[model samples]
Every structure is written in C-alpha cells, then in structure tokens.
Target chain A: MGCVRRSERIVRLTRHLVDHPGTALSLTEMAEHYGVAKSSLSEDLAIIRSVFEQDGNGFLRTQLGANGGILFEVDVSTTREQEIMAEILAQLSDPQRILTGGYMFITDVLSQPQILRNVGKMFAKLFAKEEPDVILTVETKGIPLAVITSEYLNIPYVVARRDHNWSEGPSVSTNYVSSFDRRIQSMSLSRRSIVQGARVLILDDFMKAGGTIKGMIALMEEFSATVVGTGVFMATAEPSEKFISSYRSLVTLAHMDEMSGSVVVEPGNYFTERM
Target chain B: MGCVRRSERIVRLTRHLVDHPGTALSLTEMAEHYGVAKSSLSEDLAIIRSVFEQDGNGFLRTQLGANGGILFEVDVSTTREQEIMAEILAQLSDPQRILTGGYMFITDVLSQPQILRNVGKMFAKLFAKEEPDVILTVETKGIPLAVITSEYLNIPYVVARRDHNWSEGPSVSTNYVSSFDRRIQSMSLSRRSIVQGARVLILDDFMKAGGTIKGMIALMEEFSATVVGTGVFMATAEPSEKFISSYRSLVTLAHMDEMSGSVVVEPGNYFTERM
Candidate 1:
C-alpha cells in the first residue's frame, strides 16, 4: 500500500470508474484499495476528472465527507455529438443500404460495438437527468440500443416482444395501430419484466409512425408504470404527426427516394434543438 | 510534447485502450498523445498491463515496430469466472423463474449491462483466437448476448430474424428442425448481414437442441460464410445429441425439476476444461 506507483493508481481508478458507471464510491474504499490516504486519492481523482471532462468523454462528481464518494456521468460534448451524428448520417446515406421499401439497412451500424457504445453514451447523456427506474423497448431491433443505454444508466431494460412466448409466463398484451400500414398489431411484455409504478424510459432504433412507441407506452400503462421519456435513433421526417406528443431522436430521415435509391438524413432534435 | 504527469498519461492510456479494444496502436502515436517519450510511455503501459493482467480483468499485448504497438484483450480469470457463474446460478435458481417449459427467465440478467459485459468478456476470451469477422445470433433473445460479445471481440454482429421482413430487402431463408418441439421452423438473414466466405462466431443466450445455432450455421452456409466458433450462456445437460458437436457455454443446467420448480447448474466447459 505504501509504494503504489502514481501511474498504477491512475489506471486502476480509470478502470474502476469505467466499469462501474453511475455508482458512488466512497473515498475511504478507494483510498484503501489504492493504498493511499484520502487526501492523495482526492488529488488523483481531480486530475482524472479534469481530463475526462475536458475531453468531453464524461465527468466525475465527488461528494465530500465520510459518506460522500464519487460518481461517473457519461456525456457527449456538442462537437462529439455532431461528429457522431454526421458519421451515422453518412453511413445511412449509402444507396445500397436501401431496402425494398423506404427502410434502410442499419443493422450493420447498430451491430458495431464502437458505434453502439458512442450512440448509447449520447442517448444516456440526453436522459441523464431523468431518474428512470427501467429502460423499455419492443423487440428486436431496439434491444441493443436499449441494453447499451441501460448499461450506461445503470438500470435494467425490459424488451416487449412482438409475439408472446409461453415461457415468459403470464404477460399483458396491447393492440395498437401500426402506423406503417395502418394495420392493427399487438406487442406484449412479460408480467415480471417491470414492476408496477416504476418509471420507464422508452428507447427504440427507429420511429416511423411512432406506432410501436405508442404500443409500448400502452403496455407500460398495463403495468401501471410511468412513461418518463422516449428516445429513438432515427425517425422519418414524413408523417410528422407522431402518435406520441413528444420524444427525442438522434437523426431524422428528412427524405428518402426509393425510385432513385437516395436518402437524406439530418441531425434529430437531440442535436438540432436541445432542450 | 513534455511535462506530462505519470497519472495523467496512465488515465488517458487506460481510457483509449478501453475504447478501442482489439486494435493495435503505434507506440509513436501513444507517445505523442501522452506528451512523453517512447520509453516513458512504454513504462506506463507496462504498469497498466501488469495491473490489468494481475487483476484478471483484461490484458494489454505489446508488439514492437512502427506498425505494432499495443492491443487490449479482455479475459475473465478462473476465480472471477467461478464467482460470476455462481452468482448467475443463484439468480437462475429462483423458483419463480421456472417457466412453463423448463426454461428459466434470463431476460433481466441478459439485459443488465454489468452481467452481459462479464459474460461477454468470457465468451470473447474463449473465442479470442478464432479471428471471427462477425458475430451471429438469431433474434430476439440472443441479440443482447451477441451484441455484447461483438463489443468484446470488436466485431460486427448480424441477427437472423424468425420471420423475413421485406424492409430487409433481399434475404436468404432456410428451414431447420426445432429440437425442442420437433417442428420445422424457418429463419432468415439479410443478404447484406454477412459477406461471402466471412468467418462468423455464433452467440446465444441459451442452447437447447441447438436448433437455433444450427439454423444460424445453415444460414451462414447460404451466404457462403464460415462458422468459426459458437458460444452460449447456458445449455441443457440433456439432449446429448446436439445438431452441432463443437461449442462452448458458460454454464450448463445439470438438472431441473419442473414439478418442484428447482434447478441445478454447473460451470460450462469454459471453466471445467482448459482449451
């Protein structure tokens, strides 16, 4: 404990903060682990915090006192957010990504670990102030985004399935009109997935007519849960009349030409107009 | 570039290495970023590497040369693996988790970022040497596991859907026998999901008769891809005759009592036998 190298303590501190996001750790525990006094540990955390905040990666909040510790909050700087959105827009602009319908193939982008982590950080930051008890999204495309966001938020995520499997036990199902085809479709959530009266945040990969989001909100109501906020990676500019009154999107598909196979995307409300 | 503190360089090095895993960065670049000479940067990396390796969280591999620098490789130590498996086993042992079909409720655990990250690192390490170009899994349960594994391996993941959506554009579908119900089920993958002759690593949350994994392998064949390795979080001890013989699991359900609603699980091959 007496001879711990300065570099060694810094690496351990950074790794600990990275691994356990949103958790407040007491200086006493950290000091003991690093084999340093509380005063020296505070200095090390100060340097790490300054570097993290200056770089726009995240911030370390320290609460002074015997019980007060530190918490790591991940945030995306305006510049980083723009860079990420631009990269996503560029990726989604490929003509080959266009499918039979107006849908673009975003599975590749969603599947990339680095891209998913970055986007997740962006969304987590946007909703950082919200005390969401649980993250909710309907299967299956939104699963990754929701899971990653839940990770950063230090919360559990519940996925509503398009079809109910008996293995999920008793579940509550709700029918909502599919905005895409104006057809009625139902989504179900396991009864145990969420507790009643819990605050829920809805996360999805895309928002077309917002039908799925609406259905999810309804499903949440079945659990008597509160719908705190909703977020989507992309939303079609058309059908501006969304099912939900309010939500957030990272990018808006301003235009899509199936005949010519072209896509025009712009940053969503998260960037274009911040709250 | 000068006057960089040891703690400062260590923190940056850890953050950068964590962000970009499985990629080699040049020592020159690292030296420049840390504002220190190559020798000092090397010393910092050595300290970071030792702490990481000793802790069994992950390791940093250094390669000499202009092109080669350091690569972050994540691996769970034997003791850590046992602790994690034990914890999961306890959670899975919940009586209420027993589903109508002998399946245990694992959605909550899989969606938890901490649990998924740990399990993912284990799977990633088991297949670390495989050189997989992509990770594959069928929706919707396996999406989180696949995504996390892809994150650790630093590769893209492609999810095969139970039904083909026109929005996916051109896709290849195949019929495979479901081992559970002995029913024929069809799964499809977007043509763009994987490139021909690409090496693929399959990941799943649970393995029964291995029908889903087998179906994924067939789907890969349709795309002219190679199945390098397959990993699952849990597998049934019974059904000795699997669709595929070679695979790895983190835990195995040695026994389950549907009547009594009890389950017994043991650590998977990942811990029982050395590779």
Candidate 2:
C-alpha cells in the first residue's frame, strides 16, 4: 500500500466511487487503505470529482471532519438526458413499433442494458429527493426498469402481480379498470412486500388512462404507505385528463390513432421544452 | 489533453473501459483521445488491469494490432460468487421465508440490487461459453434476473408473458405445465421479440419439477430459437427426475415442508460439493 503508484490509486478510487454510489466514505480511511497521505487522497478525490462534473457524468460530494465523509451519486446529465430522449423519440417514430392496441412495442428498447442503465439513473436523479424506502411496479415490463432504478436509488423493489400466488403468502388485492379495453382488472401485492408507514414510488412502462397507477395507489393505501411519486416511461397525450394526477412521464405520446394507425411522440415534462 | 495529469488520464481510461464492456477499442484512438503517447496509455491500462485482477472484480483483455484492440468484460470473481452463494443460502435458511406452497419466498431477496448484480455476473460467467445471442425468461419473477444477466453478457433479453397482450402486436403462443401446482399453463412471446435461429439462454428464479423451464423451452422452439443452456437461481433436489435436465442452478433446495413449515437449502451445483 505504501508504494502504490499514482495511477493505481486513481483506478481503485474511481472503481470504489462508482460501485458504492450514494454511500459516504471517510477520506482518512481511504488514505489508510492505500497508505497514502490524507492530502494526497484529497487531491485524488478532487481530480476525480472535477472530471465527473466536466464530463457530465456525476459529481462527488465530500464533507470535512469525523462525521463528514465523501459521497458520489451517479447522475444523468442534461446532455445524457437529451441523448436518451432522442433515442426514445427516434424509436417511437418507427410505425412498425406500434402494436394492435394502445401498446407500442418497447420491450426491445427497455431490454438493452445500456439504455436501461442510463434511464434508470435518470429516474434515480429525478426522484432521489423523494427518499422512498422502496419502489413498486406492476409486473412484466416494469420489473427491469424498477430493478435498475432501485439500484441507483439503493433500495429494494416490489412487483405486484395480476394474479395472487399462494407461495408468496397472503396478499392485499385491489380492483381497477383496465386502460386497454376499459375492463375491470385486479392486481395484488404480497402483504409482506412493503412495510407499513413506508414511503413508496410507483413506476411503469406506459400510462394511458392511469387505471393501473390508480390501482397501485389504492393498494399502497391499504398498507398505510405514502405514495411519494408516480413515474412512467411514456403517457398518451390524448388522455389529458388521467384517472389520477401528480405524476411525471419521460415522454409524451403526442398522438396515436388506432383508426389510421399513426403515432406521434414528444419529450415529457421531465425534459426542458426546446425553444 | 496534452497537459492531462497521470491521475486524470488513469481515471478517464478506467471509466471508459468500465463503460464500454465487451466492446473493442483501438489503443491508437484511445491514445489520441488523451493526446498521450501509446506507451503511456498502455502503462495506464496495465495498471488498471492489475488492480481489477487483484481485487477479483474483473480483468482487461488487450489484443495487439490495429484490428485487435483492447476489451474489458466485467466478471464475478470466484470469491464474489461464493459471497453471493453464501448470502443466498443464509437467506434461504430462514423459517419465516417458507410460503404456503413449495415456494419459499424470495421476492425480497431477488429485489436487492447488489445481490442481483453479483448473481447476474455469476450467471453470465457460467453461460459465457454458450455465447447466447439473447436471454429469455417468463414473466413476473424472472424479469429482473434476466435483465441483469443480459446486461452482464451485453445482450438483449425477451420476456414471455402468461397471457397475450394484443397491443404488443401478434404473438406466438404455447402451453406448458407450470411447476408451482403442476397445472398446465400457457405463455406467449411477441413475434418480434426474437429472431429465428438465435442462440437463447433460458433463466428463472426457481425450478421444482422444471415444468416452467420446459414450457419456456417449448416456447423458444416456436420462435425457432436455439436453447443454448438453462440457468435457475435454485432447484429442488427431490425432483431426481426433473421435467428437463441440462440446467445449472445457483443453490439447492435440500428440503422444504409445507406441512411442517420448515426450510433447508444448500449451495447449487455450480459450487463444488463439500466432502
């Protein structure tokens, strides 16, 4: 540790910060790990932090003293966000992605590790202030998004299933109208999935009438939990009046016509409107 | 770029390598990015590679020649694998995790990001030789696992749903028996999810009679996908003759009694059996 090269120390420091996002670490302890002077460690941290900020990757937070420590939270910069938005818009522009119903095929896009990895960090930064204890998303499409977002937020995620499985133990059930056909459908969450009085964030792939999100909100109420926020990958622009309010979407489905099978999409409220 | 310090160069190089895992980049271009001499860049990469190898996180593979560039693949070290396995076994040993049916509750466990991150890399390493073009899994429990594994392998993942959603466009369907209740259940994948003759790796959270995996295998056939390998988080030991073979699990469910409400588990076949 005493004779470690400068480059060696920098690589290890970078890896550690990337891995333990949102966790604060003492600089003195880090210096001891590499047998370096405290001043040298601080200098290294400053260089890493400056690079991250300049690159728009994310910045590091360092505090002074015994209780104070250094922390790094991976972020989605404005440039990065625009890149993701462009990707989503470009993909949505393809008419073939439009499906039989209101559903547009996005499984391919969401399944890409890099896409999800970036989008997850975006959601994490967007909602990091909520400080929720857990994230909740109905199963199938939202699972991967929730998993990655939870990782960035450093929390566990619970998935509600359309049907109850006894193996998951007792569950709390709620019925809601389906956005697809307006049919009444019910979803359930395992009773043990969330603790009472916990803060929760709800996320999903798409929102048409907000029926599913409404149902999840009600389910959260049953557990005496607070719904800090509701997030969606995209939302239909036609349904200006949704079943529930107080939600944010990453992209706006400006138009989609089942009659002519046409679709138009734009960036969501999460993105700044271009002049 | 010319005045970049050694720490700055090292940090940027490390971040770039970690970001573009599995992608080959020319040393000459990388050297130009920093306006550094090729020799200096090589020294930086060697330092990064040594640290990663020493920490057992992963290693960098640098090939000589212009066509043959440098590549990095994030991997789960043997020590990391054992740590993940240990966590799985300890969590599975809890009596309260026992559910009404054969299902020992694992939703909470799988929801953790760090655990899934490591477990995903383990699956990636175990099946890297298969070089699957895509990873496939049924809905609900397996989505997160599939998503993580797909990322580690730098491949896409396709999920089969329990029911057909028309908005996803036309989909091919197949019926198979589920292990949960030995009930005949059906699943479907979007017609566009996978291409014909693609090498596929099937993954899941748990397997008992191996019925669900079998169903997935059948579903893959309809897609004209090649089943390269099957991987599960846990498998029941008593199912001496499973619905299918040729699968590797991360842990072994030595015993679970619904009537007695007891649960016992051990490390899976992937680990060397203790004498």
Candidate 3:
C-alpha cells in the first residue's frame, strides 16, 4: 500500500484498539479489513505500536498463539505520568484558569475520570511494592483517584474533611498552609476513619507547597498508621522547597511563559523510575 | 470431640474462610488446623456454610470429589444492593453532617472505596442490559463513583465541568440551578469529550433537586449522545420534580427529623427494578 493508505490504516487500527481495550485482533483480520497482505499488516502494526509507545499513551501487546492476537494495554510509567502531570500543571498555570486571587481553576483537573484513572494506575504501579492497606486523600477532588487506587489495590480508603463533621467521631485536626490561598487552613480526619497499624498511601490531585501532605502525615501519625508512600498528580517546579523530597509525582510543571503562550511539559522522574 | 470443642472448631473455620476469599480448604487441611477428624471437619464446614448462607453474604460451594473442598462464592442477590444503599443513606443523613445548612455532607460518602465498589457493582447489575458506552458525571463528588462504575463496566467516562475548559476545546455549557445554593451554575463538557452516538450513563453521589442531572442531559443532547440511564447514590424524597425523570437512585432519604435525631432511609426502586 502507499504511504497515505498505510497512515490511514494505522489511524483506523489505533482507534479500534483504543475503542476495544483488552480484545486483540489478528494480523489476518487487519489485513482483511485493509485489503492488504498479512505481512503488510504486520509492518503497519509495528509502525503503529512504535508511534503509540512514543506518544506515551500505551502499548500494543502482540501474541502469535492460536486464539491470540494483538491487544493494547495502557502501561503508564512514572515518566509518562510526570509528562501528563506537567501538561496538566501547564494547563493550570494558564492565566485563563487562574482566578484574580491566584486560585487555579482546579475544577477541570478534578473532573476528568480518565486522568484520575491514569494517575491512580501510576500510583498503583509505584507503590505496588509497598502493599498499602489503604489509600487516603482529603475530601473532594482527591477522592476520585484515591478510591480508584484503593480499588486497584483491593483496599479500603478514607477521606479527611477540611471541616469538623459532627457525624464523624472525635477527629484529629492539623493546620496546613493551602498552596492556592497561601493561608493556613485546618484539615481534619475522624479518629475512627484510619485503621490503627494500617499502612496508608496518601494521594492528592495537586501539590504546590506540600503542606496538605504534611498535615496528612501528621494525621496518619496520630492514628499510628504508617505512611507507606505519597503520590501526587501534579506539582510545580518553582519554589524548589515546595515539594517534599520523598514523594513521587507523575508530572512537574517546569514553567509557563504566559507572554509567549509557551508551556514546557516533560515526563517526570517517577515515570522513568517506576516503569 | 465434645460439643464445645466442635463449636470452637466451627468458629475458627468460619473465620479462616472469611479471611481467605474464594480459596477452598480441604477437609484434611481443616482437620490438621483444628486437630480434629476429617469427618468432624467436614461436618463443621457444612454447618459453617449453612450458617453463612443463612446470614445472606454468600454460599460455600463444596465439591465432594478428590482435590475438592469448600469454596466461597458471594451471592450477589442475597445481600440485596438496596439494603446496602439504605444503610449508606442512613449514614449520610446524620444531622451532624447536615448541620444548619440544608445541604448534606457527602464528602465522606464519596471517599469510602468499598461503598463505591458496591455502588458500582449495583449499577453494573442495574444497567447490565444497556452496557453503556460511557459513564458521565459532573465534577467533584460524583467523579468517584462514576470512576468506579466505569471501571466496573470497563467503559470510558466523561465529566461535565462547571466551567468551559480551553484545553478541552469548544465546550457546550448548560445552566443548572444548584439545589443547595439555589444559584444557577453552568455545567460544560468539551465537544470532543463524549462520542456523538454513544450511550451514556449519568451517575452522581447525591441528588436533591436534580438540577445537575438536567444540565447533564442537556449536555448529552448537545453531543447527540443517548442518555441510556441515570443513577444516584442517594436522592431526597422531598424533591418531587427533579431535573430529570426515569432516573434511578440507590437510596431515598424519606425524612430526617433533626429535633428527634431520627432519620428515615429506604432502598430506592432502582434496586429491585430490572435494568
């Protein structure tokens, strides 16, 4: 087939693979669909898989056995996670999402389920060795991915609320400086929420100054729960001391030159280190 | 063995079975653990299985042939997803969570991974017939269960944000009156977020006036996507005319008498209805 025809076929196959995850299609089937030889289809798949891996979305797993074909598995690495996070931070850093008071429009970041799943999977892979008893996050945005990670690990999760909830038993409160507001706010968790002696993995959507993680660490300490690891979806590269040293981040925002509309995003260290 | 000894053996076996999900313990192994006869262990297992099934969690499927023993298979219908939802709604209706504001505290409701998993499993059963293409939810709280349900169904999900996101491209926005604040807010979705002809299932953590659901429906219409189903974790009975009709709820809050500290919660019709 011509180059143009091959490119079109690759795009069609990519869409099909994405649309039908876990199901593999044989080279013969692809060849039949494209009215091409099996050898031609193999070459096309090789090019498509290479492009897909380069794009950092996922990879195509090929099998040659009877009843085996090719399947697309979303194997996100720490570096890719960081790349995605940098992209997210770049989006957040955009003046459009920034409110007058310097608050980021986080509603978009919190709403996307696919992003949450990606982040959760990244965390699961990073902390797989930890074998945490549960995933924990503060109420609201972090709840989505915390729950997802917890599900991935087959563990329960608890959320810490910012305010005092009467329904919850006596809670342990700690002061944490909010990165968005730059003001110290009280974060609280019910004493009954965290299981004693349980290993907890803390996850958050965005961490600029790492104050929230600090407070969570304090709460976990109060409950005698060990903090197995910490994971964040995105972090800012500025204010070098803002992020804690031990934590893993999927993406780091290097900088965004608003004047030039130039946002630089790259894969983070976690992606490279984990996957 | 004496009756007390046999009872102790049964209790120990039951605990072991609960701890090891789906693993079948052979009679010889059980006898070795309890230092009892194989016949006695078999009898104890039979009794434990019967009691467990009576309690309605699941059954212990026992195979009598060689290399067979007792394996636990959870009975999906026995626990009655509706009963679980009612319990969750009752927990949410705590006056402590409501405080002075009419708005209920639901952040904790979204954080519980087990509850979210159960909710997802319930929705999977409810929408088993439809097999929705994507799970849809508005931002924040709804994202958790929506992610879980999407994972359960193995389908992609789209979230409608309250504001237009430039990164998401030109989004369609719909005005939704907030049930708690009574303020009209716009929920927007990128034009590219959802498939045009896909069947979408909308999910939310809580439904009071259902304004958000209505906005979601409008958003789906804009994309020319079919709204296959709508489900909520909890719904208030007070809201007679919600934003949409033909929606399903796991639990309905019938009443909460703050003065008496009495809360009335019941399973919604969605639990028993066919998908």
| TM-score leader | 1
> Model 1: per-residue lDDT, tens digit, B93-171?
7777778777777778787777887888888888888899999998888888888788778899988888887767788
Model 2 per-residue lDDT tens digits across residues B147-245: 888877778899998988776778999999876667778899889889999999999998888999999999888988899998999888987789996
**Tens digits of per-residue lDDT for model 2 on A23-133?**
677887888877879998887788898888888777787656666788877777787789888987898778777666556777788888778887888888888878888
Where model 2 places Cα greater than 4 Å from the true spot, the runs are: A1-4, A26-32, A62-69, A258-261, A273-275, B1-4, B26-28, B62-69, B258-261, B273-275
Q: Best candidate, DockQ-wise? A: 1
TM-score attained by chain A of model 2: 0.90
- Fnat (0 to 1) per candidate: 0.77, 0.79, 0.20
lDDT of each: 0.84, 0.83, 0.68
lDDT of 2 at A216: 96
Please estimate how well model 2 matches the true structure, expressed as its whole-model Cα lDDT.
Answer: 0.83
lDDT of 3 at B199: 93
Steric clash pairs (candidate 1): none
In candidate 2 the C-alpha lDDT for residue B217 amounts to: 93
Q: How do the residues A123-231 of candidate 3 rate in per-residue lDDT, one tens digit apiece? A: 7657866868778898656777687777555567787878876645668988888766678888888776677899999998767789889888888888899998988
TM-score of chain B of each: 0.93, 0.91, 0.69
| lDDT, residue B119, model 2 | 85
**Candidate 3 global Cα RMSD:** 19.1
